[model samples]
Target chain A: MPGVLDLVGIFVFAVSGALAAVQKRLDVVGMVVLAEITALGGGILRDLVIGAVPPVAFTSVSYVVVPLLASALVFFWHPHFTRIMPAVMLFDAAGLGLFCVTGAIKALDYHLSPLHAVLLGVITAVGGGILRDMMSGQIPSVLYDRQLYALPALVGATVATALWQQPQLHGVFVSAGSALLAFGLRVAAMRWNWRTPRARGVGD
Target chain B: MPGVLDLVGIFVFAVSGALAAVQKRLDVVGMVVLAEITALGGGILRDLVIGAVPPVAFTSVSYVVVPLLASALVFFWHPHFTRIMPAVMLFDAAGLGLFCVTGAIKALDYHLSPLHAVLLGVITAVGGGILRDMMSGQIPSVLYDRQLYALPALVGATVATALWQQPQLHGVFVSAGSALLAFGLRVAAMRWNWRTPRARGVGD
Candidate 1:
């Protein structure tokens, strides 16, 4: 069975994908494709970078099915679904936290350096959304939006990596602590409408 | 030393990436990043899927430097470069042809099925451009434009994969033939302003 955290993360990511498809006014096939890609793209990217063959995403049937089902649900009930966009975004933040921490641990298992592991972790949290936004013909939200999105993931990943380096640290505790930090930061940023600084004079 | 064909392909792809960065009014750092990604993203994607770790692009200083040079050239000499945009695109077609054929051959070396090899080949040809377009906040030209961009690459990759299946055919000859077919088709498509059919209701 997939972990509860993993399923929750997938659900939120899938919903974000569905939202992009609806925003684009794409068809049913497009919705499913976008959802699957958005939900799984980050993990697939991490696996590839870490040299994991065929990736778990391709090897597991449920991984593929869950996202498609989420897309389908969104497609048929968009009116009710979009109404909860704010709550959904909050869940997405939580998913981001979970993914970043887990991704860092996985990279460490593969013997990546702490720096590379943290980078991979951040990628696992945010890469899918970048892919989705780009595919939808918009600037990547992480780059363009006035939110401290990517930074929170980076912070969480860094925390996870640092904790893992301690010989006495339990991996589960590291993961849980990292996730909580990231999740708290993301939720706070959203609630406060926090903005990351733009390059001076570039004026984004 | 990298093959002559590989260098030429990288040069053209780098130019295309730099063009995107310039259009987006991004800084020098952005130009280099975009160029590197455009020149190497497809091959990296292929390598990852094939379980090739520490992708060749990362290992080779030349591959990294060449694209940076191309981007710098474009940044300082935009007027001269843009004036020759048509010629640059022709070279890009040649590069596309080379990458698809070579990419398929590489996939075959890893014992992938012919179908997967061919798919990887096409991906290796066009994936970078998709990334570039997405980063530039535009719809991918391959998906948005009616031109036979991806089709030519698909034809070349399929040809390469099929020829590799023949015991009597030398891999070099197979690559040459595939590249020629794709390059010829792309040039013809450009000269004649040929187009692929769009989905009926998509209404391009």
Candidate 2:
């Protein structure tokens, strides 16, 4: 069940990635690469740190196929889909929540500390977006004054860790609840235009 | 003494990186970014994996100053330089040798096993180039038919390991000689156009 949801997270993240590529006006190849990384990047980092086998890129056909399809959609249908950013943003938030919970669970399975698992979960949620921004020549929005992006993942992972502490509580409720926490926080942040304050030490 | 050599290695590698950017007709900022990554990339990877705090990027002004100077060279005077490709190749090889040897020593200092140290050394040598290629949408040359690039690092690291097996043979000779072996083999491979053979099963 977790694995299936993880795939869904990857698929929607890829669609968001293709949307970013379209916004940036990249070539088809760049669009595919961006989408792949956005979908699989966090998972890959989590795997490498845990010394997992083959990497998801080689281990799962869905990982590749889903991103390719997403890329194709954005490339061929951008004219019709440009106004769908709101829907894409919503799905992206859901994907972030899904990846954060899954990544934390995976880290715990590897016998990492709860703290480390939470960190990994947060990385799994935000690392791909960071990488995407870096590749596309933008300051990672995570570093910008954007809304509470990474914070949502951190909060979600923390809740997941609390669930993990109770052996009986480790079920669909924890996953669903944690994901909702993240998605709701992010949507609120966006709607309210919440942002982190900048360091005032430097001048323009 | 070795630190000085590493600094020189950074300078040369930065030159190569800046030249690569120039060849691709990128602007100044791109040249600087590529140059900085080429110069400090291997060490950065090494530090990160070792759980070393304040990765070289965070602490060293030399790492910053040298790459900027290299980029300036390419930006201001590349038009006057001829046979840029060979210069880039030679410096790249030199940087590879320096990184391979230094990385092995660092791994040993961290008390890793011989095989593990050697693996780290190889990663330190080629990992940056692999990343740079990925960002630029190019297949890594090392993954292709290119001759024994990583193999040289393995051999050098192995030699250092053997030296460690006997306490009597220590100090500069063991380290420098191992480094020499790596450099010589890599240069020979480059000069001879050596390559891994392709095709498998029934030959086409």
Candidate 3:
């Protein structure tokens, strides 16, 4: 079930890229490249760290084709995606949460400490988004000095890791709770315009 | 002395990428991105693997500017770069060798095992070139059915790892010898068309 929901997260991220591409007035090739990077870059980074060759997305036929098709659809038909932006957000939150958990698991698999695992989880969740922004010549999300997107993933994954000793209790509930928590935090931040205090100084 | 060589390597790589950009007919923006990535990508990958943040390239102003200037030069003057192609290849080999040594030393600094450090060195040597190839939609050198490029880095760094265990030999000739071996191997391979035999049958 958790694995299935990860697909939804990938789709959500793809839609975000497609929208960004449209807004940028990009060609079809540009739209596909952005969508693939946004959806796949994080997992690729995570897997590479753990020494997973080809990464799962590269080997998995479903993961490879789905994003491309979605990009094409969005490229040709924007009206449909316009109505479903909210749904994409929900699923994307779920993806962020699930990917965060997966990152921690992979890091721990590499024998990293809890703190290190938590950091890796945060990176895995947000790395793709940052890459997408960089390729598009926009400021990365992390550079914006935004509130809690990465921090919440870090917290949620650490919490899950804390509870990981109960092997039987580890599957579905942890995934759901993490997804919900990340979603809630993101929604609250969006509504309230919450932000981390910027590094402030006058002109140097 | 080697610090200067490393920067020279960075310039060679940046120029190699910029020249590829010209050959590929990329725009100025594309050329800059390719050059910077070729110059910085391998080190960034090495740092991330060792759990270092921001990567050295981000923090180093000279590292950043040299690649940008290289790309700009290539964009404006196609004829000069073409004439200097042979010199660039020699420098590119030297740079590849230097990156391998630096990567191995860093991995050792992070307390990785000799085996892992050698692997890291190979990655550092070949990773940027392969990534540059991938972004340009070409087959990566690592995936090429060709002479030992990355493999020699693996071998040379392994020798460095063993030689460094001799307290008297640490940091003197061992490092330089390994780098020279890798560079010499590359030059030999290019000159003689030396190659690893294909593992699979060549395509019909």
Candidate 4:
């Protein structure tokens, strides 16, 4: 069973996905499908890459139920949700932070190298959003968005990886600190409108 | 090590993917990346779902090498390929047919039920194309294209699954027949412009 933090992360992510479906004018079925995909896609991708078969998403009933509940909530109260978009974005950052830390830890548990663990961590953080964008027929914002999204995840993953090397560190504290760093960075980036530089001479 | 037939399928799929990259005016690196993704994404998805660790695409040198060669070929000779787009489509059909059969057999090997095997088979045949279209920021053609694409893969996968239930049947012949059936259906659909009907009253 996933912890409360993980379930909260999945619920927020699922809500984001359901909102995207509504924005695209998709029907109820599409809302459910998108919500499930967004909530589970990243973890599934990480599990697949790390040779963890029967991914947790498939095996855990709570993982599936949380997404469904989120979808239902969005479906019934989406107009209210639109008014609270900022709050949703903040929650999304928390989800990203939590996913990056947990994903890295999971990869390390599977005996993957630190570098691979970090890479997988970042992937798990952003993959669901990428899938959500693509399914909606949009370019993944992470690839070209000026905002510092993936960079924050990368920083968090690196921090987790670095801390993981020290076995004596308290595991819960290490994870909490890394996730908090990522969440803080993401929130700051949004607040200050921080932007990554565009590639020179490419788009121009 | 994959057989010659599997290599051919990967090569053709890679060619199709590279051609898409060229059509979208992507760079050489993009071409290679798309080629690899299109060639190996389906099998990898199937492998991941069935608990096959470190999918063949990662484990086998041939799978990686074949797509790289195909990408290079398309990079230098794309104009010629554009002129022979019909031929490319036919080859793609062959790849679809081969992948569906092989994917189904692999699922059955992993002791998945016939229903799951059939589903995986179709996914393996179409997953790469969906990923390619998504990565390129387009709606997946298989989802909406007015052509018989995934249907043929379903037919092939169903056939393979049914035949696998009978151990006395010759493995080589059963696979060959199933693949040929799928290839023929796809060719006929293309020649006749067969299309699946859109949902009634949805778009309207």
| Native interface contact recovery, all models | 0.22, 0.00, 0.00, 0.23
Give the per-residue lDDT digits (tens) of candidate 1, residues B7-75.
889999999988777666665545665787799888988887787785667456667778978977886
User: What tens-digit string does per-residue lDDT give for candidate 4 at B130-194?
Assistant: 88888887866775565788889989999989988999973789998999999999999999988
What is each candidate's DockQ, to 2 decimals? 0.15, 0.04, 0.04, 0.15
Residue pairs of candidate 2 with colliding backbone atoms: none
Clashes (backbone N, CA, C under 3 Å), per candidate, total 0, 0, 0, 0
TM-score for each model? 0.63, 0.57, 0.57, 0.61
- If ranked by TM-score, best first, what sequence of candidates would result? 1, 4, 2, 3
Which candidate has the top score in lDDT? 4
* lDDT against true structure, model 1: 0.84
Candidate 1: residue A53 lDDT (0-100): 60
Candidate 2 CAPRI grade: incorrect
When candidate 3 is compared with the true two-chain complex, its DockQ is 0.04
Would you list the clashing residue pairs of candidate 3?
Answer: none
Interface RMSD of each: 5.5, 12.0, 13.7, 6.0
The candidate with the higher TM-score, 1 or 4, is 1
TM-score of chain B of each: 0.96, 0.90, 0.93, 0.97
lDDT of 3 by residue, B5-26 (tens): 8789899999988777666655
Models sorted by DockQ, best on top: 1, 4, 2, 3
A131 Cα displacement, candidate 4 (Å): 1.8
